[model samples]
Target: MQQNSLKLNSDKTQLLLIGSKSTLTKTNNLTLNIDGISVSPSHQARNLGVIFDSTLSLEPHIRQLVKISFFHLRNIAKIRPSLTPPTAEKLIHPFVSSRLDYCNSLLYGISNTSMNKLQLVQNAAARLLTHTKSWHHITPVLKDLHWLPVSHRISYKILTLTYKALHQLVPPYLSELLSPYQPHRSLRSTSARLLFTPTSKLRSFGDRAFSRAAPKLWNSLPILIRDSDSITTFQSRLKTHLFSSAYP
Candidate 1:
C-alpha cells in the first residue's frame, strides 16, 4: 500500500510537470538530442535555462569541458571583475591556449554577446549560492559541463542553470568574500586549483530544497536574462520562437 501511494504521488508530479511544456523542458535531466531539432520547442520556448545531471546522455568529454569552462569564467570575473576588455583578455589569453576542449566551441559556438550572458549567469550563480549555504554540495556536479556536443544554446542554458543551482548550494559572495578560516596562502592555493585544474573534485549534495525553489526563481527572471544574440534582436525573436502556449 505504501509503495503504491509513492508511485501514485510520483506519477502525479510527473504529469503536472510535463503537462506544462515550459516547466517540463526546464528540468535538468537531459534527453539526448543528437540532432538540434528536438530542442526546437525548447529553443522557441525561450526557456533554455535548465541544467542537467551527468546521468544524461551527453558525452563525458563535453561534460568535462563545460565544467572547466564554467569555473574558469567564474574565476576570471571574480579575480578582477574590473579589468578592461583588452586587459581582461590579456589575463584571459593565457587560458585561451588551454588544452581544454572548449576553446574552439566558446570562440566559434557562443555568440558575441556572451559577456552579458556571463554576468547573468554570475547573478544566477550568486542567487543560487546564497540559498545553498555550502560549496561542497555543488562542486561535484559542476565538474560536468561541455560546449561541443551539448550545442551552443543547450550549453548556454545549462551553464546558466548550473550556476543558479550551485549558487543555491553556496553563496554569491563565496568567491568574493574570503573565509578567514583559511590562511591567505591556503585560500590562494584553493582558488588557483579550483580555477585551473580540470580534474579537481567539486563538492556534491543530495537535497530537494533546490527542486522546491528553482521553478519560482526561474519564473522570476526575464524570459531571457542575457543577450546571447542581441537584446532587442533576441527579444523579438524569442516571442516568435516560443509556441502559442508561451508566457512567463
Candidate 2:
C-alpha cells in the first residue's frame, strides 16, 4: 500500500510541474472520476496551449521567427538583415537633418558620450545629396565630430565619399579644412605648402584632372617600390586628391 501511494505522489508531482489539470471526481491532491482515474484540472491544460502559441508567431516571411533569432545573433553578423526591409532601410539613414540638428544632438562636449556615430554618417550623406554646397558643413562632422573613415562604410560615408566625388573641386572653405593634413606645418605657410604636398588633393581641378594617372603608373613600379615609395606617394596623393580646393 505504501509503494502504491508513493507512485501516485510521484506522478502528481510530474503533472504539477507541467501545469496540467482536468475535471473528474476529486481529492485535495487530485481531480478524479467516479471511475476513479485522477487527472489534472481543465484550466491548466488550456493555459499550456496558450503559452506555446505566444512563443511563436505564424507571420509570413517568418518575420517574428527571424527577429527573435537575430536579436541574440547581432553579434555574429549584420543581423539587421533579419529585420523587415523597411525597418532595415530606415536604420541605415542618418538620424539628423541639418548642421544645427547635428550640433544640438550629436556634438556633446566629450566624444565618448555619443552613440549613433554610424547613423550620423548616413544622415549626413543624405543631406549632402541635396546640398554639396554644404560639404563645408558636413566634412568636419565626419572628421572631428562624427568620426567615420570610409566611402565603403555606407552609401554616403562623409569624407571619403565626398573625396571620391569632388576631389580638388571641394570648396575653399572645405579645402582650408584639408590644410592641417598638408605636408608643411602651418596654415599661413600652406599657400605654396601645396607644392610641398604634391599629394595634396586640395589643388586646382585642372591640375588634378589628369590625377587618375597614378593608378595606371602604379603597376609599372617594382613590388618593393610599391611597399615603400608607393605608400608614401599614395598617402601624399590621397591627401591632395581628397581635400584639394582648386576644382570646379
Candidate 3:
C-alpha cells in the first residue's frame, strides 16, 4: 500500500494454509491479523475455479463438481429422448465434461477412489448422451462419443500444457519446469525430444507436480506423436491414442 499507493481490502482478503494432513492438523486453529484486520483461515479455497483444501486432497472440489455435473446430467437425461446423439453430445460436453476437465491437471496422481468419482460422472454423461442402458459397458459408450476416460483427460490436459511449455508457447513459469530428457550415452539422434522428470522425496505431492507428470506423460507418447511439430497435430494424434488406449 505504501509503495504502490493501493490499499488492501481486508474484508475481501482470505487466507489459506496448505499442507499435508498432519501438517494441516498442526495449523488448523492458527489465525493471523493483517494491518489490524483478522484474517480467518479457510479449510478450502477456490482459486481460478479450482478448489484447494488444506490437505490438498481435492475431495471438496470433486464433490462440488459431482454435485453440479449430476444436476445437469439428470436434466439432460430427461430430455435425451427428444434429442439426437450429436446434439446431446454437444450439450453434454459443454455442461458436464467441461466441468470434469476444468483445472483437472491438479488431479494428476490423485488416488483411484477420487478418480473413480469423476469417472462415474463422465460415464453417466456418456450414457446420458448416447442413451445407453445403465447395465451397458462404458468402454463402448465412451468410444462411441470419442471421449477419453477421466484419468486420460487429466493426462491429456497436462501433456497439452507441457507441449505448449516446451515449445515456448506458454509463459516462462511453465516452460522452465521442463527439461529435455538426456541419456547418459547421448541418444541425440532420436526423432522427437523427450523430457526429464525430476524426482522428489515427497512422493504424493511430487508425483502430481507438473515437472514430474509432464515428462512422464510426454515420454509415454509414441515417437510420432512426440515428434509432432504442430500443436494441433499433436493434440489430435494424442487424443486418438488415448481414446484407443481407453477403449481397447
- On lDDT, the stronger of 1 and 3 is 3
Model 3 residue runs over 4 Å out of place are: 1-5, 188-192
TM-score of each: 0.20, 0.20, 0.92
- When sorted by TM-score, best at the front, the candidate numbers are 3, 1, 2
Q: What does the lDDT read for residue 7 in candidate 3?
A: 85
Report the Cα lDDT for residue 215, model 3.
88
Cα lDDT computed for each candidate against the true fold: 0.34, 0.32, 0.86
Worst 10 residues of 3 by lDDT: 183-192
lDDT score, candidate 3, position 21 = 75
Tell me the TM-score of model 3: 0.92
lDDT of 2 by residue, 144-181 (tens): 32323232222122322224222455455534433222
Please estimate how well model 1 matches the true structure, expressed as its whole-model Cα lDDT: 0.34
Largest TM-score belongs to which candidate? Answer: 3
Error of 2 at 55 (Å): 50
Q: After superposition, how far is residue 46 of candidate 2 from its true place, in Å?
A: 58
